[model samples]
Target: MAIRNVLQLGDPGLRVVSEPVADPGAPEIAALLTDLQDTLTHWRTTTTYGRGIAAPQIGVPLRVIFLHLEQPWPLINPTIIAHSEEQMVVWDACLSFLCIFCQVWRYQQVDVRYQDLQGAWHTVHAEGDLAELLQHEIDHLDGILALDRMTDIRTMCTREEFEKRYRERSPYAR
Candidate 1:
């Protein structure tokens, strides 16, 4: 269980649709979760931004997501159960594309069902940034990147540009 190299943008492995995690308690699943935690921690420590990561981002094509919000945890075989009609656009980034951010529209609210490492099932209702984060990570399971979700191609910009133009200068600052 070590920090694994994150698959960069354009890696073919990043496009593979992740398979459902059949056994949440499998040793491989545990190892993958550990790798995700280590990798996400390393990224956040260095960049000050990563909050969540998906298994596929680390070359493990399994439906798993590691989140470091108020608490750190893993969601195994996550699926969106419901979404609100209202949508909002926000700047989204990815571990695969560490240098850029894209404006993407996502549902304002979502209900997700997922399993724990112990194989127990649970559901979570998320909204705002947490909802957006869940949707972003779930999209990775289907081979979708934040770039692919952009409503306007022109909205994509380098992280440095994003910081200069919008980080604290605009109302869109996240």
Candidate 2:
């Protein structure tokens, strides 16, 4: 398993809706999950951004998502099984979109149906930050960016400005 370059926003791969993993028990699927973990680790260590990644971002058009919450969780072919009427809006950024951030509406509490790494079906309910991040990553599988779902996109910044302001890169903006 190797970490792959995340496709940028303009790439056709980013727009292609991913296909679900045919066999959750397949070896390649497991490897893809590993790579997704790598992608998550890259972002978590290299930036103060996110803790999850979707397959499309890493050049794989599979309906797969790697969640790095308390432990590494692989959500293969996940589907939103249930959603609450309660809505919440949170500032979100996509790895493929780089420095751009947007606010999106998501169910405050969501029950998702997904298969685990061991090919067992699992249902989990998430709220707050993890819920928001999970929903954002799942959107990637559907070829939807946070920008597209953003209600009011007022706060905007280029990669250079964001990096400088967040001390992510060269702190020359000061």
Candidate 3:
């Protein structure tokens, strides 16, 4: 597993919609899951901001995502099977976006169906931050972002405000 460079906003590769892994059991897909896990671990140790990562974020054009809670768990060819009727709004900041965050509406809960790194299938019913993160990462695979999910772009914070709110993690000063 290697620590792959995350693609920036201007990178054309990020715009490409990822292709689904038809055979989640294939070695190539398995290797991708391993790499995703490595990135999850690398960011956890290096940045202290490892939570969720999408393949598209790392320039991998596959329908793969890693949702590493405090524990490392990989989601390969993930699909959201169900979601709560109730919706909630949260401030979302992408690793790709650095300091920027937008108020995005998402379901309060989501039932996810995905394959594990070992190619075994599993189902997860999650709410709150986990649900929000799944929706967010899946959005990335579909070439979408928090900005796109927001009802109003005006609600998004100015860079100054964003930096003030997330002072330590803000990349604006960089």
Candidate 4:
């Protein structure tokens, strides 16, 4: 598999809701997973940071997501099982919009149900940064982006500006 080009924010494909993968064991699905990992790895190599990617981000309208949270894994037809009542705000960035960052409010925790590469169902409990990242990627499957999660347009800023003015104090600060 090769690194597929990531669709940009303005791309019509990015706005399309992904369809669920009917056959998780399909060969095409495997290739798509590889392509996703390759793309994510390539991006991380260049930027030094990347956590997750949804199928739609690569112009694939399939309910699939690749996550690299200490361990890399593919999530198929992922659904949020439950979320905490509490919410937190974070400066969110996206590969689709590398030029900007937006302040977004997200659930503090989440329980997600998803399928493994073998097509077996599984669930994961995530909190803090992991919770935020999963929510972001799942939103992509529904044709949602971080900008849409922002309460005010004024809170959005150029990546450079975010770095200069808020990076050190940002919740996502390294």
Candidate 5:
């Protein structure tokens, strides 16, 4: 269990599609989950912005993600089974690319199927902030970044610029 360094943008590893976890209850997965939690915690306390992290962010090509919301939630082999017809534009930032924020559209709601550490399957219905968060994290598993979803290159801006011009108006800010 360690605070593994998050792979930054432009790192080739960040663009590799992660493999499905063969065993959700494997010891290595447990350790990876711990590392993700630690890394996300460190990011939140230090930068005040990270809500979740995917395994690939730490150079692990596994379909795992850790989210810190009301609690620490680890999803193994998560897949977006359904998504709402509606979408919303959001100013999204990634721990992998903390220096910038990109404007991207995300589903307003989603239903995800995933496994727990115990290898049991479960489904979650998420909407609003939670829905956007899940979609972002899951995209990481598929080797996609918010930058890839940007509608226009001009919509991407420096973190400082985003804070100055878009932070308050961001849907995630609410």
Candidate 6:
């Protein structure tokens, strides 16, 4: 278990679609989860902004997402099975794109089917911040970024500019 380097924006690896994990309980998958935790923890301590990370972010082409919201939650091979019609536009930032934030619209609610570390399947109904986080991390599995979801290129701004111009309007502002 180590704090693997997070792939940055424009890194070819970040654009590759990750492969499905055949065995969630595999030793390697456990190690990958540990690496993700170590890396995400490091990022949060340094940047005070990371909530979750995908395996692809650490150059691992696997469908795995590690979220540290109120607790550590690992979703393996997660798929959005359902979503609400309601949507919300949010100012989203990615560790891959460290300093840039982009405006993107996401479902207000979603039902995701995923496997656990024990290789057991489960479905989770997520709304609000959890829904958005799941969608963002899942997008990484499909080689997409928040930048690709922007409705207007002008909506993209640097972190500093976001704080100065859009923080008051951003639900994610902390």
4 or 6, greater by lDDT: 6
Inter-residue clash pairs, candidate 2: none
Better of 4 and 5 by TM-score: 5
Stretches of candidate 2 exceeding 4 Å from the true structure: 158-174
What clash pairs does model 3 have?
Answer: none
Which lDDT values do the candidates have, in the order given? 0.90, 0.78, 0.78, 0.90, 0.92, 0.92
lDDT tens digits, residue span 26-114, model 2: 88998888888887787777875657789999888999998776788889988887888999876566788866755578889888889
Range of the 10 consecutive residues with the lowest summed lDDT in candidate 6: 165-174
Q: Compared with the true structure, what per-residue lDDT tens digits does model 6 show for residues 138-172?
A: 99999999999887898888999988888787545
Q: What is the TM-score of each candidate against the true structure?
A: 0.94, 0.87, 0.83, 0.94, 0.96, 0.95
Query: Which stretches of candidate 5 lie above 4 Å from their native place?
Result: 171-174
Please report how far candidate 5 places residue 100 from its true position, in Å: 0.8
Q: Worst 10-residue stretch by lDDT in candidate 1?
A: 165-174
- Model 3 error, position 43 (Å): 3.5
**Which regions of candidate 4 deviate over 4 angstroms?**
169-174
Candidate that would win on TM-score = 5
Q: 1-174, model 3: which lDDT tens digit per residue?
A: 787777777777777898877787788876777777787677667755557889998888888998776576778778899999999887676777655667789999999888875678899998987888899999888888777788678767754586577545432222
Please, what are the lDDT tens digits per residue for candidate 1 over residues 118-149? 99999999998899999999999999998888
Which has the higher TM-score value, candidate number 1 or candidate number 5? Answer: 5
For every model shown, the clashing-pair count is 0, 0, 0, 0, 0, 0
lDDT of 4 at 53: 91
For model 4, the local distance difference test gives 0.90
Candidate 1: residue 84 Cα off by (Å) = 0.4
RMSD of each: 2.0, 4.5, 4.0, 1.4, 1.2, 1.3
Q: Write the per-residue lDDT of candidate 4 for residues 104-168, one digit (tens) a residue.
A: 99999999999987889999999988899999999999999999999678989998898899888
Off by over 4 Å in 3: 158-160, 163-174
User: How many backbone overlaps does candidate 1 show?
Assistant: 0
